[model samples]
Target: MKDVSGLLERTAQSQGAQPRCPLTGTLMTRGLTVPMDWRRPVTSRERQIWWNADHSFGQIHPRPALDEIPEFYDFPTYYTHDDPNSLDSAEEERRIGALGRLLGSIAYRFERGAEPTVEWWGSVIPRGARNGLEIGCGNGDRMKTFGAHVEATVGIEPDQRAAAVAREKGLEVHAGTAEDLPPAIRARKYDAIVFSHVLEHTMDPILALQNARDLLTDTGILSVEVPNNASTGSRWMGERWRWLDTPRHLNFFTPDSLRACAQSAGLTVRAVLFRGYVRQFMPDWILDEARITAAQQRRAVTQADIDRQVRHSARLLAATAMAAPEKKYDSVRLICTR
Candidate 1:
């Protein structure tokens, strides 16, 4: 196999130019197009195709229902779950969570100058506060942080297995898609709703947001995080940028696209800010391709490659942060209100 590190460097180095908005003809704020190479085009045959072709593994885009949304026909998957970049199994996923907590702790100490509260699950808890809903509450990491303050904390997840794990961890999780939210959840109201890296997967993102809105109590807050379409990493990394897990992520959003969708869903884009995370996994992205290409076939990435990717990503992320203005590049965390 090829040297994973070298491949990663090339992958990250390849697409150096920035991308522009397909709709507006202006430079996209993040490289939203990088995931396209992994995605298949949308068609009536997609559902059938999904079932036939590695449905358990690869990302698959469903044709957008014609009545509500236009057929975006072209977009990319945001992440992959199998051969190319499979993380450890469910039993081992805890280490990834541990890494997340460690990162959050570091950021809180150095940047926030205060202990970061796990308030996402409790952001709306009423002690005269509001209730909160967490969408795609993977493993309850954010929810665990929120357990203290909210009057109510609920999470909606589509994966049954993941939901079971979250429940075991003491989080109130519902096993259902954003489109098919349990009716019990749909009937309640919340004070805050969160969509963290979860919106890109839905076929009808606007409708999903609208559904979230419907569950909110009066004067609710909606918070979200999405990979920035114009970031330098994406512009340079192209298809190998980890965020572009194609087929699974059907839509890409710029600030303009986001605002448009939020407005249509009866939500107002109140605040949008760029946030940075360690670019550690990036080197692995390139290395995976090189390993497969060199082997002349599909295969799994090695642990050594993953370790190197993390180290490289960390240094790059720090360098990018120090070198760029906060506004000039980064993924976005948008805060909205209704």
Candidate 2:
């Protein structure tokens, strides 16, 4: 494998150059061309899904079933169990909750190590503006960190259980999506609106951005962080890319595509920065590829397979860390103004 750190630095240096769109073969000036026929329907016995191989976009079947929202907290297969109406036994729920916490802790440790402050808003956050909002504030840890810099912080979460957890931590969390902000929240303007790893899950990202724009003050900033589809990790992993968690992540955005999307929604991009998440991606890729290969062979994933990938991933993580610079990143964070 190429040194992850060296690859990242090379990628960063070429950020200004335009790359050809994989689908259209056109030199992408702003965004890649998304063909109407690019969607390939994926059929399963239970449900239908679609994937745009060219643009890296995934969509769930049963098309416009608006009320179907999956319960994100339900355990071992956190997001894999996609039945929106499925319920678990009390014991199962407890196990699932514990697993969720454990995974969240691991992710938090990695993220905090990558960005100690966890506030990548840059100069977009104006001085003396102490109010902020976070969309899809899962578990509220990031919101807690934001609280350190702001006097007042609130969050909009669609998951009822997750919202309750955030409320328990004394956060002013509303149990809903950003599309319809409660009247009280809508009445107040904010210095910043954060969509940390949330926009990709939204059904309509552009509309979500427009709605978020409405709640912002004239000088308020919108800080978005999403997995970069144009990253070296995506190029290397192809179909096994960790970020392509389908039925959940609806849209994949590269920096250029995201900037164009933001501009289309009437937000002006100010700055774009990347954050390295090789630790997360490399291990996930190993695990997912193993699971996929096992499924293809009509067999269950074994402990031995899991252990082997885990061991290999550990080595890759160590190498990546050693090669990576203190400031190099994998995820793209964009700061925009309305």
Candidate 3:
């Protein structure tokens, strides 16, 4: 593991005085202006077709090819929530499907080779907590894990299919967004609320936090994990950064900005730890870029091609680990108290 304490101190010292939003008093950071057709719904059928065509191995969907979309200083990191083109269930399914396909492919590669290990943010959950809620809980793997410790665990997932899977696992899951959480659930308080890799998708992170706060006990903890926009990998990959899943990942945050957003929502930051090295993403990036190159040349991408790329990626990861063991990580895990 990297020296988390040292990284935290350096991040604080480098950020200096944190900037706040004028209206909401939220911490402000640079925003990307990538205009998305939030109204454009990519259906499950569409995603299936794309995957069947092997597009999942490459850029399955077109994205804005710019460094920064345009910067806006505001409370809501994203502005198109209420727009006619904003995301809906069908559209969200499409987005999730694409992501699932990409992750599945990565898993396939890992199963065949030296699988990369990640220190899951789920470990932040307090052992003594009795009950907890996971916002945007996906298929509820984390909820299942938490349920083992906590007496009762509830999950709020937007994907119906995924929710079904969670229910089959005997998890208490509700199908919907946090904004529209069931009143029965909303009335209950939790010892901890988890927002693992979910906040970046929200248009109003502050509001999301505020809603989460309402569901937590006075002393409850909010554990959040998000991709670090200011990571070395982000800078190195530029537009091709795998984490830059535009439209889906609307808000890019640094530790300072994330703390600002959490504080604005009536939460006190307890700790901000930059966690997990992303040696795998480097190879994923190379493969994605290579696919584009191959497409332009009217060449077919083969399994041999993918195997070669994966081998190269493994070598690159080894080199980076050997040379710079203390390199900056690609994600930030924040623990906040209400």
For all predicted structures, in order, the TM-scores are 0.60, 0.65, 0.59
lDDT of 2 by residue, 53-140 (tens): 4444333332323354453233433432233423344432343344322432343345533342535334356777778999898778
Candidate 2 Cα misplacement greater than 4 A, ranges: 1-64, 71-124, 281-289, 292-298, 303-329
What local distance difference test score does each model get? 0.51, 0.57, 0.53
Prediction RMSDs, each to the true structure: 12.7, 11.6, 13.7
Could you give candidate 3's per-residue lDDT for residues 162-206 as a string of tens digits? 576678878788865655566657868888788878887654566
Candidate 3 residues lying further than 4 Å off, grouped into runs, are: 1-127, 278-327
Cα error, candidate 2, residue 97 (Å): 28
Which number leads on TM-score?
A: 2
Estimate, for each residue in 126-205, the C-alpha lDDT of model 1 and write its tens digit: 35545678887766667666546666688987755556667888878886656557776776787777787788766556
Ranking by lDDT: 2, 3, 1
Better of 2 and 3 by TM-score: 2
Please state the error at residue 48 of candidate 2 in Å. Answer: 7.7
